[model samples]
Target: MEEVLKKFKPRVVSTGIKELDEMMGSGLLDDSTLLVIYDASSFGWTIGVQVFRRMIELGGFGVITSYSFPISLLEKYALTMQYDFLRDGAEGNLAIVDVIGSIYNLNVNLPFVYYPGSIDSETFLAKMEAVYRRIMKERADSRKPVGISVTVDALPDLFGEDVAMRILRRNLLMKELALMREERERPINILLLNRERASRRFIEWLSQYAEHIVEFRSTSISGVERMIARKSLLPSFTPSEAEFRFEHGNIEIRPL
Candidate 1:
């Protein structure tokens, strides 16, 4: 991967996986928020990390944030995924917002990591905005920026569903609406949620707001997994399922 992004449409980005992107009508829509719902004990979370790293490889910036998962664990598991967060953060390519570390008082000593310092939901979002604004200041620069949330299901656990919904309504759901109003390319958002951790009502509510929804399921009989496209707002989205396996850090998918 080079330090510059390959030529791409202003409102479209690659999911990094060739087969997956092809299924997504050439690539991901800039204004769409993708909600990836993964089954319990599945390898779906790793998919989020791979997508984030791919965005950076495309000469774009991305923020790796999570509520239930922390920076330490992400780095530990991402060792084989070929992404160096600390080094990239130092190089001004990406950042990590550790929600669990900040709210639960966990020890994460990453230099470029941001913590909310308080339990207030507004403050947490403000910290996230600061990260975005700093990157937005790079007007002369050409790198696109994206957002990643590894555990959106845990947000309600922090501030209750009411407060979390309010925050999301102001930020996420409203952002979806704003995208409808204007074609301005804002940050592409990728959210990973565990279906078991969130209530059906809550998941259904969020699903309606998502422009795309992917569900992950793994079978106990074999080492393969299924990545199903439950909902898609892409006009050209036609492929329905992708059967894949983790082969030496790469996802080999057979679109079905």
Candidate 2:
């Protein structure tokens, strides 16, 4: 037991929330694909935005991908917390992979943002890679880019489930392969999924791809919700629920 223990030294990348860090066994594991399952009505996306914000602050190029909304809304989101989105983007610490905008062939207006001229799993992934390469090339000291995709459930509804699954599978495969090869340090991808909008099978598939899972459920009372670490690769992780509220630009998570 002593010999085994000697070889075990765990480390984590801080998520910027101390209590949440404890819930996830110190903090988020490196190269972790974390799934954030949530209901449609809850303030689920807030959790993801916090992670993205921290990633940028920590010198990781942060990428925000939204299938449910556009860049305009993301700008509004930064305003909610009074975050320094403009400065981060200007410094290349933040970027956006506008999936919806890319699908519609919208013109780009930001240097830190990327959207493909064509729509397909190949082009989409290529553009994401382009963003990654560009950031790392320009910022030699920056960490691997971390990303958060809001409302992954919308992908299926936007495209048929079959196509969306294919896209997801391709994305997972790419990330896993890169991680396995040690080409670069893989990023923490926080994917927010609204369970009500996706098929059961799709959620199951999502569970298989992620290294960690955080599930959120809203109560009948307005502005109150519960979150739990549903699944995790960390040995210290334990299943427990914590109630939280999103009000006045603050996230109040109460201990049970």
Candidate 3:
């Protein structure tokens, strides 16, 4: 029998937690997407913020599509770590896409525009693609590998029941687009979903697009939860389970 060759893909993004990385096949593969399901009391927001901070440290670009809370909250979260979130945003290292500000009737004074109303699937995808391209162009001179991290915070909550099905359908399509837009091996896509609030059907469909899945389970005890992290690329992987806490600008994932 003849042996077949496989192309190599590097793992460029790290979860910043040593144990979690060892469990997740040495962090996420380059150009791969991760789906994170977090409960109300878990550290979902911490995961997203850390990814953004990593991008900044690497001199890479990031896009954060906020559908759950104001980007200001993320900024405040970063402040605890002694990070100047506003300075980074002004330098074009990160772009915050505020999708729910207008819908919630809050006056957001950011350099970017907010949807301010119900957002459809089409518009959301377009805005994402545009920000991605703009960032890539700005960094063309550096000729660095396009390391782009996209974080979508609480997707389903962005729309109404009337457009629920449409959003799901569009999400399926967006996943396809994400797979198609891999220019070189340098993209990191992250989707943070509120598992308690997300429908099972929606999750089932979205999981199809995720290369890695990390689920956070809340416990009866406050401020502590369990994390089950797995990688799809490694079929032999036994999901690593751990108890973690997101506090004081740090995430600690300890073996359960």
Instruction: Choose the strongest candidate by lDDT.
Output: 2
What is the full ranking by lDDT, best candidate first? 2, 1, 3
Candidate 2's displacement at residue 153, Å, is 1.4
Deviation in Å, model 3, residue 47 alpha carbon: 2.5
After the best TM-score superposition of candidate 3, give how far the Cα of residue 110 lies from its true spot, in angstroms. 4.8
TM-score of each: 0.84, 0.87, 0.74
Ranking by TM-score: 2, 1, 3
CA lDDT of each candidate?
0.73, 0.76, 0.61
Residue-wise C-alpha lDDT for candidate 3, range 1-256, written one tens digit per residue:
1111122334446655567666676676666667777765566556656665675576656556666666677567568766776677677565565656645667567663234344465565556556555655654334333222223335555554336546646655764564455444355667777667767777776687677888888887787887787555654456788887877777777876
What's the lDDT of the predicted structure labeled candidate 1?
0.73
Which lDDT value does model 1 have at 157?
84
lDDT of 3: 0.61
lDDT of 1 by residue, 85-204 (tens): 777888888777787887778856765676766668767666666655565564315566677887899888888888888788777655645445543446778898999989887899
Q: What TM-score does candidate 3 reach?
A: 0.74
Deviating ranges (above 4 Å) for candidate 1: 1-10, 107-109, 121-127, 134-142, 173-185
Please provide, for model 2 over 1-256, each residue's C-alpha lDDT reduced to its tens digit, 9 standing for 90 to 100. Answer: 6644533333468888877777877788776777888886777668777877877777677777767777777778777876767678778677767778877776568787766456664465667667666665665354767888876888877767888888788877776565445455557788988888888999999998787788888888888988887887788988878998888887877757
